[model samples]
Target: MNQPWSGRKLHFVGIGGIGMSGLAKVARSLGAEVTGSDRAQGGHDARNVPAGATVVFSTAIGADNPERTTGAPELHRADLLAELTQLKPTIAVSGTHGKTTTTSMLVHAMPGESYLVGGEVRSTGTNADWHEDSAWLIVEADESDRSLLKLHPTIAVVTNAELDHHTTYASSRDVDDTFAQFLARARDAVVAPDLTRLRADAHVFGEYDGPLAVPGAHNRKNAAAALTAIEIAQGTAELARELLATFEGAGRRFEVVGTANGATVVDDYAHHPTEVRATIEAARSQHPPRVIALFQPHLFSRTQREARAFGEALAGADMAVLLDVYPARERQEDYPGVSGLLVAEHAYDARPGMPVIWAKTHATARAYLQRALQEGDLLLTMGAGDVNAIGRDLVAHSEPPGR
Candidate 1:
């Protein structure tokens, strides 16, 4: 369908972000002329920016950004979503984790459905798709910035509630309260049974018995949530189960980047302590010879808040390698200690014989991993930040053992 922004020129600041890029792609698909600039040096310049284009940006972009200072009309990603939600029947998938995977599963179950997932779906090679004929619009609702509160969804699905994003919430109670508010706004809702504090009438999903292609018990829960959401949307649960059985998984959620020297390398976006533990458990369930986990802590605030918990979670792995924090939008000076050091100290304290190594840089970590990985080992790169590159680089540089 033709959106109101069709035929208009749009430019995005911090366009490299998954959500921003998804919006840009959808706008372009709807016939809007789209361009964007990121912090990537020399990636964008005034020469390429179209004159009088509407400038769009996310919370991550700063005022000093060259593209943002162009004096063009500004738009926030949340504003765009708010507008779109008003126009169509919306289904918002929310939670501290599994938002991306569950949203992708829902989209996969309903072919040709319009969706804006937080991460790329490997099966589709894109994070967002705009289907003109479909009346439904599915979005991965981000609770970090409380943007999910802005969306007026006809159906809302909460995968699970947890205390993260300390910047937005003061405590776990605050997080649960905000989620309750979001759910209250929805006409119908589906949620994990653990989140029973919210209204009980909401469809609560438990363990799914249907076939699943993705590994891990968490994925089964994700599938169950997706199936319940599909049923709420008037879709068949059986078909969704069948599609989920063949689901290849979304990008960076236990994504097998490649294998080298008989060792399988997997990458996952699991930065939180709970997520880290779950990902480690998933790796263990695969019964690999050894699971060597390489983790990069995402934000300084998060690391500061959950350092001990992060260390405890890393104990689940046979061996652990910690990389310096990614510090996405935070300044290092603002935080007390380096995330890697904090996690390393606590991890060693928690698991004395677990063999934890603090590789302060990518080069150091790569070198250490190359020499350490043995045949039949499962090398897992876990984090929400750029640590996924480690697995990709390993895959690109190493050859099969027999080769």
Candidate 2:
């Protein structure tokens, strides 16, 4: 099954990244010699990379990176993923929010298939796996850089499409068009009812009226999408529905850290306004006395473009704390006058009486949260960055004496 990748040597320049690490695991299991390096230097992640291998990198790796100048041939990450697609009938899941969870659901429902997901699958304890004897490959397709267009999937699944990457796509229409093109290239497509406006001929997945192991109405919809995709590719959803009930979901998709000070701490990767609102709404299902949202806005452009929407989403929480914009791959100087306060101010206006603070520093944000959180409260951290560490710390400090 891994004919082309057998015995091949591949070194990942940024192996710690969820996508890269998942890909590396699958390639290794398929008989590729895998090695990896990360910006973490000699830390645990970098030290764990195989001793030596030929260079492999992604679009995120700059040409000036020392690893890129090794004079050895290198492979693009996306290109490697496309090669895997050639050997198996691929089920590619792409959407603004639920792609990771949806892909993980499909993999968990239908076992013994190669899979590459952006986040760790809770049930499997890993993001990607390889099965030489399986006939399928499940991938969490990324649309941020329009890279999802490269793979030719046997069945393409779109949970829903929206404008999330402000830089890559100029408008929501561009996002829709890209998804339409993606669906058009697939042999079959299972899409959200909202997406029918883009591709009517594509199968319109019905909402699953069954129970789910995961929380959130949004997750129920994701399950429906996964089951529908399974039905299309395999002609049955009977067993898939049962398996999905055991699905714990992918990491950072409403993951709960232990309780801290009698309050539950949950973490989520919800940078967009829609995701933020949905996650908070899901938390409300726990029926906590109060929901405290600790959010770190991801990009300057997104915070600027969706500040009001972000505020509206935050209003769903009982109280909210906003950390400064996390300028990932974007410089603060380039985004002058744009910061998390933009959203915080809007949040303040959304509910003048609600407590909303814009903490410019992570330390201050943590301190504020530590002081404000109370018993019976639920702390839900949301971001695309490392904000989950804060929730973990809170849980650690509140743990009972020695284990």
Candidate 3:
């Protein structure tokens, strides 16, 4: 009962991604045949690919990964669509940001057998599996490049609508238009607080007015949306509050490491502006001695696009340390002259009274904090990349010299 997958063949395109990898794990746990493909030099194989199941992959496969070619399955992302067409699933999860977290929550909360495909593995389960008699099919619906349109789910959840992926959309309106299409695909759609602006005849969730177990008002809304989706899809909310209350939360999303030398070090995988604001606001609610943040930007285009907003969000912290941008699969020139310094500069403008933010290498950022930190300070390392190491290293280094 704890594991939902019970032996179905599941194949994932972009299997190495956080959301995709999580779905693979949920599927494999149900005893389904799980397989996956990833771009060349995909990182984190141990986390992404399931232990047992045939894995056929190629970064070069493109959209051609799913077609059966002379008895061999095509190794492309689109080829998986053909495969999905052949195997009609029960449920799918799709969204830009909160898909992984929400899908993981649903997998953890829902009872009975289910099949799931998402971008990351949330719980301690196999990376991918197959299930024959799943009550539902769970997936992370991504709107980037209209990839989510490929899925037709009984229920769809849009975490929130934000101005992201400037590389594709000319404006935020374009992003909204795409999401409206995604909402149209599902018989019912569940959306969070901010994303309510999207034009969808979809079902609404997360509007329940109750004190939430998760920190931040945003998470409360996320819980509500999730509960609503479950109700519409499964015919009962079924321990929704209890499940949300018990969820310790996925890794690296507000994960608190041990306190050392009177300083508390926390880490989160918040890269976008809204997420940054929400996370900082949550930390502020803790009534800590002081909040000190060390942030690593995720991508060049993202940084350049949201530099001003990023500044406004981070200024909420009492103190700030900005690190170099973490450019995943991008060239440095893609964002020339854009770095963590810009964020610090922008933050300085927003919070003039707060100490001017500092920019440092990961090592130097740690060293600066080690020298300046005081008792009762909250040190947060925020990013979607290796910046998490700063929090770990900071905690290790921040420890009282002897202990």
Candidate 4:
């Protein structure tokens, strides 16, 4: 009775990442010698990766990273995830949208299970948990890196598919084809209505009208998908539905921070145009007097390619504030003339009379919001970057429970 990774030594290159840290923790739980280093976590040799320890790296890790100099064998993060998935009955959730939320929902609705989500779960306050005796495992399968293909799960759920990774697949059809392959390899699958045809044995979940603490039509769809997978796993959905009734949601997915300058500050990890639009619409659904979207563009490539689309999405909000492109791994020098202002201008054009402001920096954005917010208004901050910090700063003076 040995774990698959028992006695193996693994070093993660960017261990500070949410996903990488989760994998490292899980590997350690399963009996691996796990060491990791993040440049931001102070420059140490990842607590010293021993000789011949296999180095595990993600797509974001570069070739020149010091960890790769160990001269040891290398493993992709997906391969490690595949190893973990094979250890138990896995319920994998993948999609262009709703993957994190849906994966979190499954973890919440099912008890006595070990799970890992790409984003931290609000209830658990961590991205992963390891239970030595659990009968099941829940994973947030990532389609962004095309790594979902590496997993072979007992049950798979694809909330929906669309082309958001500009650097990965060439077109939406390529996205679909990849999803179809992921689903085909699963023992059973629940997919979006449009994707049921991708896998002959795939299932389309029934419409969910159940009560949920999370808002949005898209989340309702996500709930339906999670419920369907739970039924497939346990042979019934009633209990799962009961558990989901009070689900609080994962971090940064419509998380309301606190009252800041009379406006309620909400933070979300909605980078894609579709997600942005959905988050805005979901906020509006709660009957807030107004939904002001303060969005920071994540990447230069994505912002350049989808500026207009993002603008259109922001049009769904009552007012829009734009911050400069975050650049992430992409350099601004590589893509000239692409900035958040481009999207702000496009947003203004999309809605002839709507107001749009390009704050250009977080400081300017925060100052403007402080002067502009009003009671009954919801200040929603959306992005994949460190934009949530601004929302937190806005509500810094507020007491606990909301901050």
What would the per-residue lDDT of candidate 1 be over residues 1-403, giving only the tens digit for each residue? 5467777998887788899989998888778899877767447555556897988878777777677676778888988887778767988999988989999998888778888998888778889988778878989999998888888899999999899999989998999988998898899889998897886789899978888878888998998898888898866677777788788889899998888677999999998999999998999988998999999999999998899999999998999999999999899999865668899888889999889999989999999998888888999899988898888998898976866
lDDT of 4 by residue, 1-403 (tens): 6876788898888889999999999989888998888878875363356786899999988767777766779999999899889888999999999999999998889877999899888877889988989989999999998999999799988888889998999999999999999998889989988887778778897557989999999989999999999888889988898889888899889998988867899899999999999999899988988899999999999999999999999999989999999988899899999999999999999998898988989999988887787777899999999899889998985443333
lDDT, candidate 2, 241-355, per-residue tens: 8898788888999998888877899999999999999999999998999999999999898888899999999999999999988887788888889999999999999989898
TM-score of 1: 0.96
Record all residue pairs in model 4 with backbone atoms less than 3 Å apart, i.e. clashing.
none
Poorest stretch of ten by lDDT in candidate 1: 40-49
Show where candidate 3 strays beyond 4 Å.
1-74, 77-89, 113-131, 192-200, 206-208, 401-403
Alpha-carbon shift of residue 300 in model 4 (angstroms): 1.0
lDDT of each candidate versus the true structure: 0.87, 0.87, 0.67, 0.89
* Residue lDDT tens for model 3, 1-403: 6543356565665667654565555445546687765664453233444444343443323333332222333334433432442354445565656666676667767644354444223453532344556556665566656667666666767877767777767887888888877777667777765666774366666554654544676666666777888888667876776766665555676778766567888888889888888888888888897988889988889998888899999999998889988887577886779887888889889988787556558778877887767888888889888898877876775667435
Error of 4 at 203 (Å): 0.9
Clashes of 1: 0
The best candidate by lDDT is: 4
Q: Which model is ahead, 1 or 3, in terms of TM-score?
A: 1
The candidate, 2 or 4, that scores higher on lDDT is 4
Q: Estimate each model's TM-score.
A: 0.96, 0.94, 0.80, 0.96
**Candidate 2 — worst ten consecutive residues by lDDT sum?**
43-52
* Candidate 1 error regions (>4 Å): 1-3, 41-49
